[model samples]
Target: MKILFLDQSGKPGGAELCLIDIAKPYRDRALVGLFADGPFKTLLQQNQISVEVLTTQSIQVKKSSSFLQGLKSLRQIIPLIIKVVKRAKGYDLIYANTQKALVIGAIASFFARRPLVYHLHDILSKEHFSQTNRRIAINLANYFASLVIANSQASQTAFVQAGGRANITTVVYNGFEPKIYQTCESDVRQLQQELGLIGKFVIGHFSRLAPWKGQHILIDALAKCPQQVTVILVGDALFGEQDYVQQLHRQVTALGLKNRVNFLGFRADVPQLMAACDLVAHTSTFAEPFGRVIVEAMLCGTPVVATKAGGAMELIEPGINGFLVQPGDFQELAQVITTCLHERHKTATMAHNARKIASQHFDVKIINQQISQLLSSKFN
Candidate 1:
């Protein structure tokens, strides 16, 4: 079936990366209509996915935007909406990959008379989104979306709690190609040596540097960790979170952790970096809709410790496959890190279990089949 996928990001976030896998199966018949042009567009091109920059203008609405601000942005995006409506008519279904996409896709779907699927990636809660944004998202999905593909049970639950239709929402975890994460020993050693992490117990944190992402929490926990423990932060700030990025640098300095911390910025070699690390940490201060990094780490056969909330709780069973710590608990996180450091054999076993489970459940082929079945059943 012909499908039109809409995303608003100019950079590759978890949701945008997930969209790449979802669109791959329908590459010949699908078009990824991006609201802005940047690295994500380039990534689509590299993947051989049909993509187009639908609008040159930016959507300035933030998750905490006021209703007036949203309306102003909506006015600016009218032309984009018209453009999407014209394009939507040529597709069997319109799949919205982000919130801003949902806003435009909802209106376009109504005007174009096409079924719309809203992929819910974020937890629609007060911690993550403003009440106005949550209301807009839920109302739009309820009224215009034929189906809502939530990234996790946490995301699905938050939508229903915010008055979304439960019947319309279903959980679908982000998929990854397990083989992509299997780095050769020589490559892992080379990466470790290149990063000057040789003989250090390396910890990797792979998310955009944001306050809610809790990069500072990791830094704080790092200060308490053994001197042999080192951290490599793998992502850069995507939004206007430069201030938070600066704050993290200052925190690392004040805590005297400059030598132990490495800001690698945004690199395309995520799987290699993950495989080189001895442990991965997901230290989000708030409830994450889905911990994509956690699954990626698992697929890389690296032991992980994630904040114990939201979808993280679904992915990890403490001491079984991986470990979990309470959100924002630096002491708990530090302790977990120390435990993993001292008990290498135990963590290694857990990592093996994690890789096996992740390979079985979150493989890209399996996830794409699930999505295809859902789309076929709903839109056929």
Candidate 2:
């Protein structure tokens, strides 16, 4: 079936990466319309996916945008909305990959008389979104979307708690290919040597540097851990969070972790970096809709310690496959790291179990099959 997918990101976030997996099966018959152009567009081109930049302008609306800011962005997006509507008429369905995309896709679906599918990637809660934004998202999905595909049970639950239609929403975890994370042993050693982490216990944190992402929390935890522990942050700031990045640097210096922390800003070699790490930490202060890094660490056969909330709770069973710590608790996080450092054999066993479970449960083929069935049963 022909599909038109819409997304509003210019960078590759967890949701954008998930969109790539979802759009791959429909590549031959799909057109991905992006609201802005950047490395994500280049990524689509590299994958041979049909993509076009619908607009060069940025949408000023944010998750915490006030009502006035939302109104202003509405005017800015009118031309883009018209374009999406025109393109939607040629497809069987309009799939929205992000919240801003949903706003335009929902309207386009109504105008073009096509079914709308919204992939809900964020929890619609006060922690992540303003009340105005939450209401707008739920109302739009309820009125215009034919199906709401939530990335986790936490995201779906938040939607329902915010008065969304429970019948229309379903949980679908992000999927990955296990083979992609299996880096060659030589490459992993080279990476570790290049980063000066040869004998150190490397702890990797792979998310954009943001306040809610809890980079500072990891730095705090690092201070309490053994000196052999080192953290390599793999992502850079996006969405005007540069101040937070500066704050993290200051925090690391003030805590005298300057030699132990390495800020390796956005790199293309994620799997290799993950493989070089002895442990991966997901320290988001907020309730993450889905913890992509946690699953990625598992697929890479690296032990993980994630904040115990949102989708993280679903992905990890403490001491079974991986470990969990309470959100924002630096003491608890440090204890988990210390435990993994001391219990080498037990940690390796859990990593083995994590890889096996993640390989089977979150395979991309299985996830795509589920999406296809949902579409066929609902649209066909």
Candidate 3:
């Protein structure tokens, strides 16, 4: 079946990365219509996937945008709506991958007479979005979307709590290719030597450097850990969160962790980097819709310690596959890190369990099949 997938990001976020896997099966018969042009479009091209940048103007709406602000941005997106409406007629479905995409795709689906699928990637909580934005999103999906594919049960629950139609929503975790994470031992050793991580216990944080991502929390936790436990932050600020990045740097310096922390901003070889680390951390201050880094680390046979909230609670089984710590609790986070560092045999066992579970549940091929089946069932 032909599909037209819509996304608003110019850079690759968790949702955009998830879209890559979901769209691959339909590559020959599908098109990904992006709202802006940047590295994301380039990455899609590298994957040989059909993609196009549908707009040059940025949508002037934020997660905290008021109703008037949202309405004002509507004028700018009219041409984009027309374009998508026209193009969507050739496809069987319009799949919206981001919140802004949902707004446009819902309208396009109405005009194009195609079914709309809204991929709910964020938790519509007051902590993450303003009440106005949450209402707009929930109301639109409830009225227009034929199906809502939530990234986790937590996301789906948040939608329902915010008055979304429960019947239309279903949980579908982000998928990964376990094979991609199977890094060679020689490569891991070489990277360790190259990064000057020869004998240190490396703790890796793999999300974009944002305040809500809690990179500072990790830094705080690092201050309480042993000097031998070092951290390597593996991503750059994607949005206008440069201030948070600067704040993190200041915090690192203030704590005298300048030598213990390595800021390896945005690298493409995430799996290899994750494999080189002794442990991976997910320290989001707010509820994560889904912790992609947590699963990515698991797939790499690496132990993980994530914040105990939102989708993270769904992914980990404490002391089994991985460990979960309370959000913002640096004391607990530090304790867990120490535990992983001290108990090498037990941590290795947990890492093995994490890899096995990740391979079974989150393999991209399995998830794509489920998504394909869902689309077919809905269309029929």
TM-score for candidate 2, residues paired by index: 0.99
Summed over model 1, clashes come to 0
Q: What is the C-alpha lDDT of each candidate?
A: 0.94, 0.94, 0.94
Residues 1-380 of candidate 1: C-alpha lDDT, one tens digit per residue: 99999999888888999999999999999999999999999999999999999988888899999899888886669999999999999999999999999999999999999999999999999988899999999999999999999999999999999999999999989999988988898988998999999999999999989888999999989989899999999998877789988998899889999899999998889999999999999999989999999999999999999999999999999999999898899999999999999999999999999999999999999999999999999988
Task: For candidate 3, write residues 232-282 as lDDT tens digits.
Answer: 999988768999899999999999999999999999889989999999999
**TM-scores of all predicted structures:** 0.98, 0.99, 0.98
Native-to-model Cα distance after best TM-score fit, residue 84 in candidate 1, in Å = 0.9
| Residue 282, candidate 1: C-alpha displacement in angstroms | 0.5
**Runs with alpha carbons beyond 4 Å of true place in candidate 3:** none
Error of 3 at 259 (Å): 0.5
